[model samples]
Target: MNIFDIPAQAWAGQILIGLINGSFYAILSLGLAVIFGLLNIVNFAHGAFYMMGAMATWMLGNYLGLGYWASMLLAPLLVGLVGIVLERLFISRIYHLDHTYSMLLTYGMTLMIESLFRNAYGTSGLPYSAPVALQGGTNLGVLFMPNYRLWVVGAAVAVCLATWLLIEKTRLGAYLRAATENASMARALGINVPRMLTLTYGCGVGLAALAGVFAVPVYGANPAMGSDLLIVVFAVVAIGGMGSILGSIVTGLVLGLMEGLTKVVYPEASTTVVFVAMIIVLLVKPTGLFGESR
Candidate 1:
């Protein structure tokens, strides 16, 4: 069939794929927003952490016989602990420096990590099969949707919501927000701002690692996979707003769907669609769809 003459089933499938992509974008960008908003540092190593998480899951399965479900929890925790150490040792040292320093430090770290993995694993992607329970597909009338993809969407939504409520409604979230708004004031009020910042950074990287774990079954663990998606995620964050939590979630999903739609109508532009949206959003809103104007 001609591209223009694609069937409804094809459209449904593409939309489902788009939603799945969007789910990942939302989760990744949510972590970015939390880190940038609270810590005032752009984490360039985020994508690296994601790669580590996927690698960790693969390692855990191959060596330790851990399943996908177990990897989901264990991988993040292990990666998060590493993040905590990095924060304490390196990231904490650069808190007083310019944002460029943090970005450069993280970027260098990303390159180092990617090189290490490339040397060990080679360029070929590793295999990671989905759990047997999620290995089937569900017929949705017009489309046959994969069970794993549906689970991904549901899990992403649940994670984003839980994160939002934690940041917007919970007591600890209040402290985080307070520190974000005015670290000195928060500290004066007895909040341990530095400790909170360290934890926040760790949490953000942990979230990225969690995304990687979720992605392993679909994309397989690869050294450069995270870098490939990082650019698009940066666009998503920009289009949604830098520090706006809701903006990141909404923008990520919307852009993912839009990218999918572009694939249907204009296949050549599919890859650039999110960046185009980013430019348009910058021109119109400047602060992003959900970002507050400073």
Candidate 2:
């Protein structure tokens, strides 16, 4: 390989990293978009919920000896049950209020949860190692790739697609959409609007939990992990415009790749690159690439 010529292996590795980041962005933003589309809540606590999911998995694996696969299945269910309780107890109280009210409520909830975790677990990051089954690296002639990274990308894509299909192609999805558009009409037509909303929230939170569970072994279950990533996800959603399911997915991966390219070209701007892109998008198209006026 020439000194100036691009190293194909390094390039492929960067793209793979970008794909993993994009997978996280896509799944997290999709969950946020889904809940917001129907409930009209900003879910400020989404990051906290994501962290809780990760923590739940770590704790389960620590105390109960649940493996990665079991944690993958159980973490979401537990976190989603918490979401249902939060929605029913606190979020439901402000359904008739302005969007700001729910936003503030969730924000407060986020702070409280963060504080609780700090008080209990402290601010230090905890390490969660990948399972033995996923511990090796694979050589694909061009580049050597970590198996866990491959698994993360695959799982995230599968979950995102499954959720999208559930919400777009099924009768339950039709009812959810109907309720989102007109709750009263949906109820009159025999749809259980409240139940639908509750389940929708649960599913949204469950998606976050899934993301968290997958992330723990890779990044470690930190108290502030979700808070940090949530900002990036928010930027992704802003640039993508949360208008359609597919748009969120595409924008996430595209932005992730863009970020990777930035790293290759301009290292200093990598951190703020997403926000900078968000600003450009807003200036050019306030409604975002896929968003519509409410």
Candidate 3:
């Protein structure tokens, strides 16, 4: 094979890898968009919560004898509960204050959580194996694809679409949007705005935790793993438009594919491609591709 002639199979594999990464980006950015859109909170600690979810999965498996499937259900719930507590005890208090305060508070929380995990587990990652059933790959004529990766992509897509439908088409989502737009009017109409806010925050964190659970098997659980990816996720959110749910999903997948293509064509630019995309998007559309202009 000529040096410049990349095989079709190789391109397929790279695209698959890009899809997997994009799935993760979509999930993480979706969570951030939901939280920020509904609550107007930046949620700097989201990555930490993601780390906690992965950690929770590992711990559940090692200590509680839970399997991957069980941890899938339990870890997100646990992280979401923690989110509820955080919202009630700390985040809720900062709602009336400047946005900077919330950012600082979440940043501090991220540090504390990361530090705690680092002190306990060190900075190294703990391996989590894929479930026995999903350990192999399927041959798709042109390319062989891992079962676990396919699952990740499918699950992420289902989640993103379901969330969008819930928010855009459902009655409960309508109430949530109403509360987000005008809490006072929502409250006057007998809606419990506070409870909605609390649940929305938990839901956002739960989505992050769900991503973490899916990630542990692929990336392994590490103290700084979330932080390492957090910046990329932020870029995804920015490129997609901060509060635009559909934008987050599409931008994440596109950027992931772009990064994958960059890796094949110009490896040196892969790491910075997403940020570069963000800058370009900002230059062209300051409000973001899907974001409404303020």
What candidate 1 gets wrong by more than 4 Å, as runs, is 1-5
TM-score of 2: 0.96
The list of candidate 3 runs beyond 4 A from truth reads 1-4
**TM-score sort, best first:** 3, 1, 2
Task: Sort all candidates by lDDT, best to worst.
Answer: 3, 1, 2
lDDT of 2 by residue, 80-113 (tens): 9999999999997887899899889999999998
- TM-score of each model, paired residue for residue: 0.96, 0.96, 0.97
True-structure lDDT of candidate 1: 0.90
Q: Number of backbone collisions per candidate, in order? A: 0, 0, 0
Against the reference, the lDDT scores of all candidates come to 0.90, 0.87, 0.92
The TM-score measured for candidate 1 stands at 0.96
Summarize candidate 1's per-residue lDDT along 1-294 as a digit string, tens digits: 377698777688778889999999999999999998888788888899999999999999999999999999999899989989989989888877898998999899899989999999998899999999898999899977889989999999899989999999999999998976898899899999888988898899889999999999999999999899898888888888888889999998898888888788888999998988899889999988888875
Tell me the deviation in Å of residue 48 in model 2: 0.6
Cα lDDT, model 2, residue 251: 83
